[model samples]
Target: MTETPETAETPFDRAAEFDRQVRTLVDRGYPSLAGVGPEAFAAAVAPLRDRATATTGPCDIDGGRIPFLLVVARGAAPIEETMPRTTLHRGRLPGFVDRSFEPGSLERFVVPEEIGLPDGDIYLLLDVERGEEFCGVVPGEAMKTVAERKRTPLTIEEGVALVTHFPEVLAKNKCFSLGGSRCGDRRVPALWISKRAPKLGWCWEGNPHTWLGMASAGGRSAG
Candidate 1:
């Protein structure tokens, strides 16, 4: 007798898994930034900058909304960027720290330490070009729980389908591309899909991949 094939999971399933992982991390205190020394903190955040560079294609932080640089220097005082003059300062570090703790804040800032505190004269710097940057420290156990949750990786086909079916929603939500080409299709109206929706899975508080920003007017009209 022939055996039956197992059903493949859908994109929604994979996204749900990702959400579960995020929730688990949040629950277990996965994104806390504590106990990390200055050097380790800087080293830890290096990859996020690299990712931003790779995705944005070597563009200067000038005029950019998100921060690109994460520096852990030898002082509690903020390290200022010499060139731009407008954005370099100590007060900015809090914003970066806050991002890790607050839900809906991670998309705004990338926290490398995720769950550690800077030891001694360690200071953090974020490369903010256009918009502002922010961060915060969270409980360790909470972050661990978040990390423990499982994630379902997305296949290329599923990724494409998600973008195609929900172009506007994806673009508006900033959920489609983590670090790659900008979502290039015509901007669609922002569709807010709650993360707890039963159709998807009861996980995050909001759509995992959606942003609130509007598309450029110069881009193709969505009407």
Candidate 2:
């Protein structure tokens, strides 16, 4: 007996096909995310997914006034329409936005002063299928540092790999953690790690002994 490909498709197959189609479209120069691979692409897209999956309320900054810029794939109308407006503004991804935003459109929001805009236009990540993605809002002065940390058009795997390989680098230099998590049904854990000061002779101030212990344990585990 020969195994035959069934016409009936499972959700997994459909999802895989969707991923492949998205990958192909992205690789062919869709803009918002021009230079990333499948993994980084997936990671970048996660934020959008997270927004879509959110059941209680939309994600907000500055008490619902500031909009979270979302970089989504072109022609992704259903996904866009489904996303919570309170949490995100459906902006075209870097390469895709050139034609999307018109002058004086409310959809476009200036990068906040506190966040520090990059010398060039900032970009966001959109992962429609999985409901997970990230936002990259680096300031002008930090562009070089951000560039050193992650390559353009990153993939989900690459993003994770980067966070894993340079955990301390990101923690100390970036002033934030790699992933986000919800807490106690009300607040989100905005975990940020502090950079080590050159003259302080300590990593996290008041946590020197703990840091040393962890380091020693880590070394032992690695060995």
Candidate 3:
């Protein structure tokens, strides 16, 4: 009998793939992800692996419109010319504790502290940008102060990167390249609905990968 390679056995070129996806998004008119409802948000998320099983819940707050989830192709790479610190460092997000998130309540979309929530929350996982910066909140675990690589969900920066790099004053819903001057790609935020992995850690899920802004996501607006 011959042994076959596992489906995931082959490593993917995450960075290259991410760049490709961004390019595609640019060609597609940069649709806005701001006002989508639960059903629509559900459709945005990337599905879990066939063998994998997990529940997803929607973050359908703000009446019906969806919030933004920013992403970048290269999050973990050190600050450089092509990729600048302004993007890796500056840029605004919504909030740490979701506005709709109740105190002491736990949900996949809610922060991972002060409460435990029931199942069925959608946490989108982008296929590209494996090493980009981002994170996720476990169902009911105490959020560790620091990430332990693969185990923690996403760093605030990675998630911010996904956000259309925008200035604090501008509240329009669009996905601008972190370094728009260089990338010259600006579109509505790329939408990816996410689900909670019961027993899994951040690394295993493979979200935006970066150590920036790991201390606490409360630095600026992270809503």
Candidate 3 has what TM-score? 0.21
Q: Write the per-residue lDDT of candidate 1 for residues 102-186, one digit (tens) a residue.
A: 4532222222332232343322222212111100112122223223532111211222222222222232123221111112222
**Distance (Å) between predicted and true CA of 161, model 1?**
30
lDDT of each model, Cα atoms only? 0.23, 0.24, 0.24
Off by over 4 Å in 1: 1-33, 46-53, 58-62, 65-223
| Deviating ranges (above 4 Å) for candidate 2 | 1-12, 30-39, 43-102, 106-223
Q: Write model 2 residue lDDT over 201-222, tens digit each, in one string.
A: 1122112121111100000000
The runs of at least 3 residues in candidate 3 whose Cα sits more than 4 Å from the true structure, single-residue gaps closed, are 1-24, 27-55, 61-70, 75-153, 165-223
Q: Compare candidates 1 and 2 on lDDT and give the better one.
A: 2
Residue 37 displacement (Å), model 3: 30
Q: Write the per-residue lDDT of candidate 3 for residues 67-169, one digit (tens) a residue.
A: 1232322222211211222221133222222223234221222223432211233222321122212223221121232233223333333344333231221
Which number leads on TM-score? 3
Best by the lDDT measure: 3
